[model samples]
Target: MWIADQWKDYEVIDTSDGEKLERWGDYMLVRPDPQVIWNTAKKHRGWKKPNAHYHRSNKGGGEWEFFDLPDIWQVHYKTLTFRLQPFQFKHTGLFPEQAVNWDWVCGRIQKANRPVKVLNLFAYTGGATLAAASAGAAVTHVDASKGMVGWAKENAAVSGLTEAPIRWLVDDCVKFVERE
Candidate 1:
C-alpha cells in the first residue's frame, strides 16, 4: 500500500463508530463513514464540537448541521486554491487526494518543454485546470455545472492564475466529447 505523507489543507484527525473527524484548513467537521466500523475512543475535543456535522438520514440523503461556520471560506493547496462552503451535501468543492495526480501531471508537463494543451473533462472547481495552468500549460476546462465553473474561476483568481490560458466551458461532458 502506498501511503502519502504530504497533504494540503486537509487532515484526518480520527475515526470511530462509522464516522470520521476531519480538519479542513481551519474548520473541523465530523461526518459518517461506513468503512469506519471500529469503535474508538475520541481524544480530540474538536470532534465533540465540530464547526459542522453531517447527519445521515434514514432515507437516502443526508444534511449538514452547522454549529458555527461561515457562509464561505478560502483554503489553499500549494499554488491551487478553493472556496469551502457548507451545503446540503458533504462537499467542499475540492478533492485533496488529487494533489498526487496534479504533481505527476505538472511534472510531466514541465519536463515536456513543449507547449502542452490539456483538456480537463468534468473539471470540478478547476483543481486540475489550475495545476496544469500553473505548470505553464494551456487548458480547456469543461464541466456540466455552471456554479462549478464559476467556482473554478474563483480558484484561478485566488491562485493568481487568472491570466493563464484557461477556457472554461459549461456543458454536458458526454455531448461535448462526442461533438469533438
Candidate 2:
C-alpha cells in the first residue's frame, strides 16, 4: 500500500460515489474513479466548487466541465516541477500518484555513487526523467507522440534541468529499442 504522501501540491481530499475529489496545486477537480464503488457521502466542500469536473458517460467517453480552469498549470514535488493540463481522457499532463515511484527512482540513482544511464519508455511528461536527471543520472526519454516528447522537454526545462544529461526521442519504443 504505497502512498504518495510526500506531495505538497497534490492531494485526494475525499472520495465518494465512484468519484474522487482531487486538489492539483491550487485547483480542485472532480474525476470519476472505477475503484470507488462505495456510495459514501460527499462531505467535502471542494466537491461543490471544483475548478473542473470530468463527467464519465455510460455510452463510452466523457468530457470536462470547467468553471475556473486554465490551459496549463504547474505542480512541484521536491526539487522537480511538472507542467499540467487537463487533456483527453480526463488526464492531467502530470500523474501525482506516481510521486512514490519518482522518489524511489531518485533514491536508487543517488545511491549508485557512479554514473547511471536510464531509458524511460513511454515517458509521458518526463516525471521520472526529471527525477533521474536530478539525481545525476543520464536519461533517455522516449515516447511515440511527438507532442508528448515536446511536453516532456518543457517539464525538464521548468525543473531547471536544461543542462542535464537527457536525450529526448520521438519514436515507437519497440523500434527505438530494436535499432539501439
**Residue 5, candidate 2: C-alpha displacement in angstroms:** 0.6
lDDT of 1 by residue, 1-180 (tens): 433336667888899998989888888989888899899888899888999999999896699999988888887777777887867567777777777788888999999979999999999999899999999999999999999999899989989999999999999999999998
lDDT of 2 by residue, 1-180 (tens): 899999999999999998999999999999999899998788889999999999988886899999999889998999998899997888999888888999899999989988999999999889999999999999999999999999999998999999999999999999999999
Go through the candidates in order and give each one's C-alpha lDDT.
0.87, 0.92
TM-score of 1: 0.94
Misplaced by over 4 Å in model 2 are none
lDDT of 1 at 177: 96
Task: For residue 28, give model 2's deviation from the true position in Å.
Answer: 0.2
Candidate 1 deviant stretches above 4 angstroms: 1-4
Q: What is the TM-score of each predicted model, taking all chains together? A: 0.94, 0.97
